[model samples]
Target chain A: MVKLTEEMKTAFSKVKIFPVATASKEGVPNVVPIGFCQLVDDETIWIADNFMVKSLANLEENPNVAIYVWGPETGGCFQIKGKATIISSGEKFDKMKAIVNAAKPGLPAKTLIEVMISDVFQCAPGPEAGKKLL
Target chain B: MVKLTEEMKTAFSKVKIFPVATASKEGVPNVVPIGFCQLVDDETIWIADNFMVKSLANLEENPNVAIYVWGPETGGCFQIKGKATIISSGEKFDKMKAIVNAAKPGLPAKTLIEVMISDVFQCAPGPEAGKKLL
Candidate 1:
């Protein structure tokens, strides 16, 4: 509902590792650490891959996914809902790899999965001050 | 797949809040946090609800969802995937509401959406020390 600011984006960028949640048709789910996920545009977020694991499989089965960018100890969080498009080879994949590699050096550029966000919002009341639209 | 320990569960419990992500057919996704999500069983995780917003709607349309429990600052994270079942009124709802209200006092029991987890895994490497089976 609120705009995602530059500060929030910078904070997100600093967070380096984010937890990605993926699920299948039968209500089975897997949560794992993703090396990189970046905001491609106002409505899209991309996640890179080394092991084409659960999130990728779940995306192939169903495009819907939820990404949580906060911890229990940390006071704030960002939650996004969107459809995941699996891009193993393409310009989009290349672009994502570049961004990820730039942020996190030395990591191999494996497959990339981009989550085109449909909605973004804050979980807690006041990270409001941290948002600055980029 | 590493185990979820008593410490992880306790840490997750202390985190007080968690992120929930959801999506629909068009590849649009929304992420938000509910007051509580507890491990109902080893393979099942339940999320409570108040707004009944995107996640509830997405679940109704499609049961697939991914929940991320991590922050940029906090070094560890948990990612889980599973099918979401909207339980408006039932024993499950009542049970979830009790668990949530007990942890976070004063919130009304609007509705409870249980995400019956199919898989559970950590997002990082060395919090490897944090897995314990309840």
Candidate 2:
């Protein structure tokens, strides 16, 4: 089991948004910007949204997802995947919203998509990853 | 449906490899380095290998996949998804191999994974994507 440190949380928290990749049964995929993800513990990250996009619908059918978070520089790429457990209305959703609001003030409130993270991995520098391949 | 460009083909062809993301029915995920992917016309990308891993097995059960390609800069992230059409030992397989060999030489031969693309999208700069969310 991988653990998320404060550094990882800080790295993820500083960013206002991340791109989520989702797909449907027919194999059509959608990527969009999401404004909320919170560190639920050392092993969980949450996302909140209620858009009826392909990505959201895809999650209802298939919960598998990959989130890409890249920094201003080329080296920071955080790719995370796990089951997207839909907590539409519950205490968990409320807690997640509070976290988001506290982290990012003045943002509008919306539905939430929480990802119970199973694994998180960071990519090395581009040249390093390429060299390892070759 | 978006079409692939010769420039996109050239951009993908030069690379010797790209990382693949896979997950099991239980929701555990994995990411690995794979050295095979070929542009099949304008809407398909083929990957080959015979590793009995989560990504492959995930495809066997659930063929939904998302591929991320990022350049070594502030931009250049091509996120694509579609069905994984497995074409083993046939005319399509042979054609894909030839393309791979021509694009990259002296590489080891392996099984192929074909992605029948349905949608393709490009990400703008980090600030631009961030602003759209805020």
Candidate 3:
């Protein structure tokens, strides 16, 4: 597993929304927009599971997740792939709950998904597109 | 399959960049930022394959695709899922090439992916999140 670079972290932070992609055990792909993903550390990211359905179901079967970090203000582009662990308890879970509740009191923020980064790919236009960066 | 609503078309047009997700035959999920996806018609869309690798390969193995549409100005959020057909020659292909070449003459715009939308799902962060609309 590779750690996300400082540049990648900064670009990720500027993103307003990104897509999280997952696949079921049957190899069926599912994707949804995510707005509560946080860069927890150089090697980990946290996503609040407020209203996931197929995305959560896919994760239950296949732990790997792919997130595309690109928006008008993201500065640059990249893709993050990692193995996700669904956390329903413990310290990180509690912190995630607090953060979501602070922003919107009614958001369930039911669980926290902790993703340990394994790969990062350049998604910027031109020759570097799809090149592995980490 | 269902046709896209006029409202969906309007919102889809506002997105500058969106995420296109695909999976290998073995179900390994992959996602990348897309800037060339077009709402060709109510039930169809097109994506130019200017720079692609794993994404195109995955589509060859499994044509199903998922695209998340959401940006600062998109007005609404939704996910489009469909079967993708890679077009390398003929009418749509020629049109796609012309559009790409006109915008940037040097771009290869190698192929055109015609997506026949089979489903639409709300992704506006509510009880309707992931609820299929079409």
Best by TM-score: 3
The C-alpha stretches of model 3 lying farther than 4 A from their native spots are none
Best by lDDT: 3
- The superposed Cα distance between candidate 3 and the true structure at residue B83, in angstroms, equals 0.5
Would you list the rank order by TM-score, best first?
3, 1, 2
Report how far off residue A21 is in candidate 1 (Å).
4.9
Q: Per-residue lDDT of B50-125 in model 3, one digit per residue for the tens?
A: 8888799999989989988887788778988899999999998999999989888998899899999999988889
Model 2: CAPRI class: incorrect
What DockQ, on C-alphas, does every prediction get? Answer: 0.24, 0.10, 0.76
Poorest stretch of ten by lDDT in candidate 3 chain B = B68-77
Q: What value does the lDDT take at residue B78 in candidate 3?
A: 90
The lDDT of each candidate is: 0.61, 0.58, 0.88
As a whole number from 0 to 100, the lDDT of residue A103 in candidate 3 is 88
Docking class of 1: acceptable
Model 1 Cα shift for residue B39 (angstroms) = 2.8
Model 1 per-residue lDDT tens digits across residues A86-128: 8878898888778767876766667777776655555553325
